[model samples]
Target: MQCVNYLFLVLILTPILSTFSAKILGLFLYPSRQHALLGTALFAELSAKGHEVTMISTFEQPMVQKKFRHVLVDGTQIRQKYSPSLMSLNVSMWEHIVFSNSEMKYMIAELLEDSSLREFLDAGEKYDVVVSELFAEALLGISHRVNATTVSFNPTGGSYELDYLSGNSHPYSYVPNAFTAYSDEMTFWQRFANTYVNLFCAFSKHFFNLPMQRSLLKYYFPDAPPLEDLMNSVELHLVNSYYLFETPRPYLPNVVQIGGFHLQKPELLTVELLKQLDELKNGIILFTVGSHRKLSDFPVQIVETLFASFSKSSHNVLVQYEGPPPSNLPANVRLMPWLPQRAVLSHPNTKLFITPGGRSSVVEAIYFAVPMVGLHAPGDDDSQLSMMANRGFGVCFRLDEELREEQLSGAIRNVVADPVYKRAIMLESELFKRQEMSPLDKAVYWVEHVAKHKGAKRVKSQPAAAMPLYKYVLLDVVVASAALLVMFAFISLWLCKQTYRVLIRRRQTEPVKHKIV
Candidate 1:
């Protein structure tokens, strides 16, 4: 009822508010397909708000091209979307790059030095504001050049935010996980490691020309904060999460977490789809290795094991196999090149989701509150999947390990039989609902607010970004020490002069004749 009332008020006032005409030139630098959709949705939403918008993407997605005509650059130069192979790196190398705080700064600086892209950016005209994807730091200089309000749009769930906001500590600060308010969770060594990372970033910044940092400040309007809180530079933070999936963080007037607002509802299944779903008597378990892994890449032995196990069972399985759907399908098993994930997840009959713990997949499952079974694979494996299992939402098993088919099957049976996991998810779903306003309304209001205000400076305040770690802690003790030492030397010299004067006076009185003559 309250929601209805709010909607009614918004509808009534919307026309009055429509007088403000704004234009947003969307700039995204990444080659990922997902970023393309985000760019599209943002362009579309802004357009719906009566804002003139144009989208530029490195690659085109079907969803984005439906509405916004995009200019495509060479994608071969861009990293492949969802490439897991590049995810591998030693801790030392990762640490060095991250700690120096220079990695993002340097990369963005080098990237923006492009003459042709600069031409596009230079062509960007009298827009009310520029909302660049976080990766589009490449456009910071351009944004500054255009005198546009620069806002950063981060799609990942607030994992990238610590670089810009203040008061949050290190390590646990950068790693995005379920939120726990401060306690002894981070150890001494971890804090030191994180500190070095920020320092390195600041140190590295000196080597780059000042244009990147200057452009960052010109548009982002953070509290003139330190390098650690770089992401805070955006006037508005469009966090890609809803209240249900996250714990309550006291959001500022500037930050909004709007997830699933643009997500289309699960489409109704075709009769064949319904018929196929109904066939899962024991239960249906949906599995995909996520986007990058070719299903053919899995060991044939493991594939054979899965088939053999499901073939014997009465339970039905819909496995997203990339290669031609396997022949000789059993009565209880089906192979699909793909299935509408949300539709299957929404099915009342669907029992459990067995997947590699990709962030998107996890969020989707959480939105439905389904328990997961993570078949964690090697390499770019289930580092995140393991975290989810540890969170008590799911169980994980190595796909290439000694865990036999029966062992995997038994775990599935347990998750299905136990009512607790499902109940916990339902509770989380309810929290999601309570934690946020309608994602659409929240997002629309913020975008307009940026335009109406004409810049983020009106709302962007979290001043912690302005100071380095040492300065924030007031560790300028060396300055104080130097002052004290100077004062002490002056006092000693004065005393020595006085003592010499007294001794000379006494000597003159006692033995003036002999010595002076």
Candidate 2:
């Protein structure tokens, strides 16, 4: 009822509030396909709202509108510089962050030096707003270049770093980092590890990342403001996360939660695929590891175990296998190079989804009200899957576990046979769908508001991004308080000792008088 009233108010005011369309620049340099889709959605909505949009992205769309221009920036060149073979399942969190930072530094440098991008910068193209993805420090330069009101597009929702920068309360006492497999209710060791990792990354960014980003920004645009100034000047943030799937925490007014902004009504599945699903009365189970990790990368023994389990299962299995599938597969098992993932999940015959627990996948599955069996790997996958399990919508198994046929098959069987997973997911889906305004609507509204208002600085926390670590975390205040307490303690102890000595001296002086009497 409250949501209905809020949305009704928005609908009534939308026409009155919206007055003008302005020039917008959308810059997305991330190479991942998922991120590319998100970037596309943002620009598409802006174009739909009659704004003049210029987009620089890896997955470029030919301009559908006369006012929109698309520029293709080849991300593959940067990707090729670092071989994909360098990444493996065994990589640690610290190593991953360091390696990722190195790659981003080079990528940003390459992007800035690109002849076309350099020309764009020199062309003096003025934009009213600049919307750039928040992952890379290099992308922040675009906002500075255009002198536009900057809005950060974070595919992953607000993190501690962003929250800290924006002066939001992101307490290390409770909240866990994305890299660690810990929840808000963490064990002592988990909390210690989480704090250690956050502090380590924060320090590393200060000493290592900031200097490199600063140097690169200066090299590209010498007259631009300092890198920290550019970041702090951001007027708004569009984060791709929902509150239900996340730990409940406070966010800044400028930070908007726009998770599921890209989701659309499901597209129809192919006739052949639909037929395959129809034949299975027991229902279908979908398996995918997302875009980055191919099924071929798995060990032969692991594949054999999965195949055996699928062969024995009563359910029909649809696996997104990029390579040649097993030669002799079970009659019920099917493989495809690609499947419209959300569409397939929406099918009535679909029973369970088996995934590596990527954020987009988990959110989509929840959107469709499907139970999941997650294979937890290192990095964000572990943390996300653990969260899903804790929420009771799914169960998670560590990929590092020793494999057995029954373990895989039994888990699937339990998910299919159990009613709890189904009930929980359905309820969650209901809550997820009962939003006041669609994520896309909220995003479009906020974006246009910024363009019309010339920025959202009034709503943003003041100057927190440029604040030093000691001040931001109150380390200085803590040290000062400790020092004061120590001084007071020392003074009190000295007074007591002086009194004790005087009393002894008085008694000694009185002893001569008493003897005379």
Candidate 3:
């Protein structure tokens, strides 16, 4: 009877005791909604798994869940200061780097001074893990204060900076820079350009971006660890990238690719929307420039060009615009303030997606098997658009004041009329959907793995992470090999010369032996 009772008690408590949860803090300080979506989805999943999650962002609360707490930071001034317009597309890469660094410095300073964030920091809350976007360096101070393992998250494909943080090797020869339009295969000039951009970005980040962040962090959180220490202490990187979208690249043990994890199943379309799309028998072209830019902000000439091009399209056009409908709006075109992008793409009528090549939009298009006619603005997802075009499922056009209606219309017509684009994307969609484990499950597992292992120290690449750039790239070894080769060549040449000299001396000293021969 005693044994029976003990077994019953053990059985009753086992299930309850095995259920584990961690206190997770997520910091996504960027003001863009597309960037916020990635972090919000990850935290929402963690919260669903019974973890107590506190999310801080500049955007509004995403979801209302029992275990999920949201802290909103007012970023109105920051957005106004750094708002990108269509004209920004014309800015040179060097100008962009300088401008973006300035924006990051301003944003960090503003975040450190926010009253609500300060209150949250002073609350003495403890957390098991801290998940932050790639740019949120100052906010890592919260992780230091709470003594949590840090996980850096990138909303797009991993960059050189992220690779450095996770100790992942990104060879500049083949692996194109995130901002460049080149694919894995490159010409001599293309490779040179890619390498130059990668080095420039690395230099700027190390010298300008990081030092300014450190100064602000020090002023705000004097007791916090050094910025370099905090950055290096990060245990894992969760990047929104995959093999299909971002060509095959090497990832370290601590780096996790969780692309498309935020994608939810397409919901049923609204009755009115379904009706609107259903009436279009030919096909539908869904057009949107993404959340970061507004059609209203576009220059009059560019907007007129877009309208004129859409007017010539045979397919019904669905434009996602915020301003009043144009007086000359074509009969084939309809404008909406927002779009149910996934749902619309899932519809059978949505034949071609016209987008500005935003990362999230590109992923969604691939997920839904919709062919794209990308009007890519500079500094946008030009690389992704290039990839899509290389795969033969999309057409890319430069979106600028110089864009002509005939050029836009012809590409749109060709993509919509051709079946090759559809076939190519359908194959890609099949591969993208064939993952063994869902991205969300994979992301959650890694986050928990880090928490359970107390910072996941075992998986970290200690040597690579601590290595200086010279040693990391093996510059010293190359120099040594070149020096040795030169020494060997010199020695061989000297020996040949000496042998000739000796033979001549022997012949001269041999008297009349040569005459006999």
Candidate 4:
């Protein structure tokens, strides 16, 4: 009877005790609200799953919950200091890269100088895992300081930098680099350009970006491990990429795609907004230049052109513009400082989405099965919108001074009139939805998996990451093969020359045989 009771108790406790709670620290200090949203959603889910999550970010959480702590940083000051002209699209890709590196350096210096963060660091707190965005690698030193497993996060689709950190293969022939506006199927010149851009970016990151970050890391965390070791110690990479929409690329075991993890169940729109949307006879068109940018950043002429185009459209327009409303604002166009983007997109009467091709906006549009007219702003938006255009789901155009009313209005009119664009996006939405596990669930599982095991050392590709550059590129093999071919060619030529010489010598040695010819 005693043995039986003990066995029953053990079985009961097995299921209950199997649940493990971990102390997690999330460092998402990037200034972008969209980036914060991704980090918040992830940490929120972890907190709900019984983990103690403390997040340091630039944005505030919508809802506060137990087991979750929020530490807010003043990202606006950093942005103003480093990137005064945040939304200028006139710069080239190289210029943008240089500017971003400088901004990240300034951001790191500011983050390290925070008094609260310094106190937290000195508190001797230990965490099982530290999740951080890959934008600022110096922040990964916090994980080392706290004695936590490092998990790097990418808010956009995976880049070559992430691939290198996670030891994932990046085939440049098919996989477009981060900056290019090209698809998988590329012409020779496109492939060449992709390879060139990838190399250039890699060179810049290593020689320019990493050194500055290392200097900052050394200055801030004198006793912490080196930045390279810290980066190599990152056991898992979680990317906001789904293969259905993003081009299919090879991923390593430690690299997980948790795209659309930020998406939540659509919330009910305000009653007044709902009534207005329902009253529109023709469908509605939603236009927003994403969260990070405002309409004021756009050229005055371009804004005027957009207004003119919106006025001519038959459908009602909802514009998320932060600038002052124009005196000539049309009756059909409504300008609000902010809009409930997800709710508006999920509405049945929403016909089209006109955006500046931010990743979050594009993903949301795809989720809601709304066709888009992409006025691509600078940065990766050009490539993102170009991919959408190539896939036949949207039409992409440069958001610049040259944009005219006809071009803007015509693209919107065509996408709205044609059912093909809608059908394409709907198919994409279905494919994106057809996943065995939700992206958020997968992300949480992996975070827990790392915490449960203490680290993901067993799953990491050690050999691939440790391999030398020449070996990784197979240059040695190519050189050896070329040498062997050259040797064989030389031997063949020597044999032929000897044979010809022998024939000539034999004829010279033979008696009087030339007259027969």
**What tens-digit string does per-residue lDDT give for candidate 2 at 1-517?**
9999999999999986775888999887776667776777778778877899998876656566777788877767765565353245566667777865566677777877777777788898889988888666657777777878888888776575577556676787788887776778988898899889888878777787778778877877788888777777888888888887777778878889888877753457789878877877788999987866667777777777778878877888999888777876789888888887888888899999999887788888989999999987554436668778887888887664376788888998998899999999999899888899999899988888898898887778775656777898799999999999999999999999999999999898884545555
What's the best-to-worst order under TM-score?
A: 3, 4, 2, 1
Q: Cα RMSD for candidate 4?
A: 3.8
Instruction: State how far residue 323 of model 3 sits from its true place (Å).
Output: 2.7
Off-target runs (Cα >4 Å) in candidate 2 are 1-18, 62-67, 80-87, 264-282, 490-517
Query: What are the per-residue Cα lDDT tens digits for candidate 1 across 1-517?
Result: 9999999999999988767767677777655555666566667766765667766666654442333445555444434322323332222334433432544454454345445455665574666777777653435554555566666676655442324442333344434222221122445665555456445444544445234555555544333444333344457767766544443345555666777654533446879998878766667778776654556556667777767666754457788876765565567667787677777887877788888666567677777778888876543324446555655677888667465978777777777778877776676666655643677677778777777786566555556545565665567777778888999999999999999999999888895456665
- Candidate 1, residue 486: lDDT: 93
lDDT of each residue in 1-517, candidate 4, tens digit only: 9999999999999987998999999998877877887788899899999999999887777654699998877677776665545557676677778875776677778878877788888899999999989787788878989999988898877687787778788999998887787788889999999999999887888788889989988998889888878887888889888886567788888888888887754557999999988988688999988777678767778889999999889999999988678878999998889898888999999999998887778888998899999997655447668878988999988878878889888988999999999999999999888888999999999999999898788778886766666898899999999999999999999999999999999999989847765
Give Cα distance to truth, residue 214, candidate 2, Å.
2.0
* Candidate 1 local Cα displacement, residue 330, angstroms: 6.9
Tens digit of lDDT per residue, candidate 3, span 404-465?
A: 99999998899988999999999999999899899989999999988777787887887777
lDDT for model 3 comes to: 0.84
Task: List the candidate 4 regions with Cα displacement exceeding 4 Å.
Answer: 1-14, 83-86, 476-517
Q: What are the per-model C-alpha RMSD values against the true structure? A: 8.5, 5.9, 3.6, 3.8
